[model samples]
Structure formats: C-alpha cells, structure tokens
Target: MTAEFAVALPSVILLLALLLAGSAAGVTQLRVEEAARGGARALARGAAVGEVGDIVRRLAGETARSEVALDGEWGRVTVTGRVPGAVGTLVPWVLSATAWARPEAPGAAIQPAVDGTSREARLGT
Candidate 1:
C-alpha cells in the first residue's frame, strides 16, 4: 500500500497544480474584463483618455493594455494582459478580454461650467 501511495502522489500533486493554474487564469481574465468595461463607461461619459488608462492599470497591473475608440455614437475598449500561473513554466497561452460601450448622447457628455455656460460653449461650439 505504501508503494502504491508513493507512486500516485506525484500525479495528485500535478493535478492540483493544474487546477490552481486554471483558477488563476480565470480570475485574471475576469479582472481584465471588468477594467475594460469600467474604463469604457467612463470614457463614454467624457472622462479623459489618461483617466481611463489609469483605471485599467490600477485594476489589472502595469502590463495590461487599454484602448478606446469612437465609432460615431459607440465606443469600444480592448484590454489585454498576460497572467502567469502556478505553473507558468508550462503554460504557453495568453489570457485576454475586451468590452464595449456607447456614449449616452451627443451633448450628454458636455459639462456645465461655473460661468453658467456649457463646457462645449466655452470651447467655442
């Protein structure tokens, strides 16, 4: 019995390590997706591009990438990053995700200023 147990212990450990690797990758993917959606929403609401990037970096680490582009009324955000797991030496794939959002309206993003005028007005139309 002892010899059989010893023979199976390595297999058990390897299986457990694989499970941990999968869990880590899943968690990283979810985090990246969340950051992408949040950043996209903020951008659609008129937030600065730098701010959107900051939000993604803060949530998903410095290696993560974020981009926002406008298509008339819609915005798309893509987030990508590498997630190393418990068995990084053996994992050969990259994990990534993307999300999209649309602006509420044309002038909806315009903010009112202290001078009783819209920011768009201050910007000269």
Candidate 2:
C-alpha cells in the first residue's frame, strides 16, 4: 500500500497543480478579454487615437499588455492583449484575447434642425 501511495502521490500533486494553473490562466484570460472590450468600446465612441491606447494600457495593467487599432472609415476598433502565466517549473506562458466593435457613423445621429427664427423661439428668452 505504501509503495502504491508513494507512486500515486506525485501524480496527484502534479495534477492538482496543473488544475490550479489552468484556473489561473482562465481568470487571466477573462481579464484580458475585459480589457479588450473596454478598449474597443472607447475607440468606437470616437476617443482620440492616443487616448484609446492609454485606456487599453490602463485597463490591462501590469498583469497584461494590450494594443488598440482603429479603422476610422469603417468605424471599427480592435483590441488585443497578452496575459502571462507560470504553469510549472517557473516557465512563463502567454494567453491572448481580442475584441472588436464598430461605432455608428456621425450621420446616423439625427438632430432637429432649427433656422434662426425657430432657434430663437425654442430658446424662449
């Protein structure tokens, strides 16, 4: 019995450690995805190019690094992030996540047009 237990113990420990590592990786992936989503949304909303990058970097923080790309003509934003992990033996692993969103065009926003006289009446001064 002792011999069998000794043989199995290492395997069990390794399995548990791998499971924990996998869980940590999954959590990090979630954070990466969230950061990507936030970046895409910011870009979609017409944030400046530099500001979009800043927002993505801040959202990713130290655990991850992110990049944001924008397509002004198509109103599209893409965000990518890499998540780092140590699965075993102090070796690092990287997981990546990406998100995209398209912003509505300016022409889509409808507003009531008012001529000078109507504008004055609406002001009701």
Candidate 3:
C-alpha cells in the first residue's frame, strides 16, 4: 500500500498543478478578450489610440500589449498577455484576442430612428 501511495502521489500533485495552470491560462485569455473588446469600443467611440491602449492595459494586465488599426469606418483592436505560472513559462503560453467595431466620425452623434423618434421617447424615459 505504501509503495502504491508513493507512486500515485507525484502523479496527483502534477495533475493538480497542470489543472491550476490551465485555469490560469483560461482566465488570462478571458481578460485579453475583454481588453480587446473594450479597446475596440473605445476606438469606435472616437477615443485616441493611446487611450484605447490604456483601456486595454487596464482591462488586462500591466504587462499586456495592444494593437489598434483603423481603416475607414472600421476599427480593430488586438490585445495580448502572457499567462502566469511555471507551467505557462514552460509552455510559453501567450494569449491574444482581437475585436472589431465600426467607428463613428469624430463629433458625430447617434442618429435617431428613421421615424425620427428617439430611443428614450419610445421607451418613455
């Protein structure tokens, strides 16, 4: 029994460690995706590229990096961050996410519906 226990212990511990590392990587990936989405939204709202980068960093981690591209009415943001943990280091896991949005012109306001009734008016707000 002792021999069997000794043989299984290391395997169990290694499995647990791998599970933790995988979960950490998944969480980091979610953060990267969220950062990209937020950056895209900010860019679509006419925010400066620097501000979008800041938003991405804030939503992700300080070590995270972002890229922004604007082409005509389209905007794209990509965010990348390193996963945290020894396993991540061993595997060199780098998580990235990209999001796209249609940017409005600077100083352009949201247009009302075709019937000329505002959303608030329809909702009685």
Candidate 4:
C-alpha cells in the first residue's frame, strides 16, 4: 500500500499544480480582456490617447501592456500580459485580449478619463 501511495502522490501533486497554473492563466486572461474592452470603449468615446493607456493599466495591472488605436471610426484595444507562478520562475504564457468599439454621436456623453475629468467635459458624456 505504501509503495503504491508513494508512486501516485507525485502524479497527484503535479496534476494539482497544473490545475493551479491553468486557473491563474484563465483569471489573468479575463482581467486582460476587461482592460482591453474598457480601453476600447474609452477610445471610441473620444477619450485622449494619453489617458487610455493609464485606464487599461489601472484596470488590468501595472504589468499589463495596452495598445489603443482608431481605424476610421472604429477603435481597437489590445492588452497583453503574463501571470506569475508558484515558484516565481514559471510564467504560464503571455496572453492577449482585444476589444473593439465605434465612435458615438456628438451628442453622446463621453467617458471619464483616469484623471477624474467628467465625460461631459471630455465631450462624450
């Protein structure tokens, strides 16, 4: 019984570790996705380019990277980052999330910037 237990213990431990890593990766991906969507919405509402990056970083994490650009009237935002692992050396992988949004009408309210400026002042609100 002892011999069998010893052999199976290692496999169980490894499986748990893999599960943990996968869970972390999934949560990180969700955060990145949320950040990207927020950034895209801000951009579409005519928020300043300078502020979009700040908003994404805050919503995601400081380690997250964001790219926002406008194509014609469409805006796209992409966020990429990696989740840290148990021993501090294993990065599961670099994950990316993206979102797209379209410009609103001039009479629409704008989104507030990271700096506390009202959407109305920014002219989207």
Candidate 5:
C-alpha cells in the first residue's frame, strides 16, 4: 500500500499543477479578448489611437500590446499578451484576440429604424 501511495502522489501533484496552469492560460486569453473588445469600442467611438492602446493595456495587463488598423469606416483592434504561469514558461503561450467595429461619424445623429419608427413611438411615450 505504501508503494502504491508514493507512486500516485507525484502524479496527482503534477496533474494539479497542469490544471492550475491551464486555468491561468484560459484567464489570460479572456483578458486579452476583453482588451481587444474594449479597444475596438473606443476606436469606434472616435477615441485617439493612444487612448485605445491604453484601454487595451489597462484591461489586459501592462505587458499586453495592441495593434490598430483602420480601413474606410471600420476599425480593428488586436490585443496580445503572454499567458502567465507554468504553461507559459514551458510552452511560450501567446494569446491574442481581435475585434472590429464601425466608427460612428463625428456628430452623426442616430438614424431611425428602417421601419421609420421613432424613439418616442417605440417607447410608447
């Protein structure tokens, strides 16, 4: 019984370490994705490029980086960051996410729906 217990202990510890590493990687990826989305939203709202980058870094981490690309009326943001943990040390896991949004024209008014319903009508006001 002692021999079997000793043999299983290392395996359990290793498995727990792997699980913790995987959880960390997943959380990091989620942070990267949220950062990309926030950056994209800021860009679409006509924020400056520097502001967008700051938003991304704040949402993700100081080590995270962002890229912005604009084509016509659309804006795109990509956020990348290193996964933090044993997994990253062993495998160099780099997680990234991209988000796209259409920039609203400066001072553009909100257009009514295609059906021509006004806000007051929809709200029963």
Candidate 6:
C-alpha cells in the first residue's frame, strides 16, 4: 500500500496543478472576450477611433494585450487580444472577437404635390 501511494502522489499533484493552470487560462479568455464585446459596442455607437482603442487598452491591461479595429462606414468593430498563461511560456495564446451594428435610417419627409389648375377645376375637369 505504501509503495502504491508513493508512486501515485507525484502524478496526482501534477494533474491538479495542470487543472488549476487550465482554469486560470479559461478565466483569462473570458475576460478578454468581455473586453472585446465592450469595445465593439462602444465603436458601434460612433465613438471615436482613438477612444475605442483606449477603452480596449484599459480593459485588457497587463494580463492581456488587446487591439481594436473599426470600420466606420459599416459600423463594424473587431477586437483581438492575447492572454498569457500562468506558466512562464514565451508564446501567449491569442483570441479575437468582432461585432457590428447599423445606424437606424431617418424618417422620410412628407410632401404634397401641386397642380397648375385650381383644385376644384382639376377635380371636375
């Protein structure tokens, strides 16, 4: 029994550590995604390009690096970010999200048509 426990302990510890790291990665990914959604919403409302970039940068912070791109005419926004792992790996994982919204059309103008002849005359003739 003692030999069996000793053999399994290292593997168990490694498994738990990996699980914890994976959970941390998942949380970081969720944060990055939320930041992207916020950036897109701001940009869709006709916010300035610089303002949108600043918003994303502030949201991402040191944990994740982020970039925002906007298509003003189409009202489309794309955000990309990289979330670093807890492990000291040099290559950070990348994630991206995009959103778009179209501006509502203005109400149409109502105009009345005119005729050269008087209204009663035109109606009768």
Q: lDDT per residue, candidate 6, 9-42, as tens digits?
A: 9999989877876776677666666766665566
Using lDDT, give the best candidate's number. 3
Q: Tens digit of lDDT per residue, candidate 5, span 1-125?
A: 99999999999999999999889999999999999999888877777676787898889998887877665566678888888876678888889899988867775433322344332111000
Model-by-model lDDT, in order? 0.67, 0.54, 0.76, 0.73, 0.76, 0.52
**Model 1 regions lying over 4 Å from their true place:** 108-125
Give the worst 10-residue stretch by lDDT in candidate 5.
Answer: 116-125
Give the C-alpha lDDT of model 3: 0.76
* Number of colliding residue pairs in model 2: 0
**Across residues 1-125, which tens digit of lDDT does each residue of candidate 1 receive?**
99999999999998998888888788888888888888777767876666777888887777777765555555566777676754754766566666766666756542222353322111100
Q: Which residue pairs of candidate 6 clash?
A: none
Scanning candidate 4 in windows of ten residues, the lowest lDDT window is: 116-125
Clashing residue pairs in all predictions, respectively, total 0, 0, 0, 4, 0, 0
TM-score for each prediction?
A: 0.76, 0.64, 0.81, 0.77, 0.81, 0.62
Each candidate: RMSD: 8.3, 12.9, 11.7, 7.0, 12.4, 17.9
Worst 10 residues of 1 by lDDT: 116-125
- Output candidate 2 Cα RMSD: 12.9
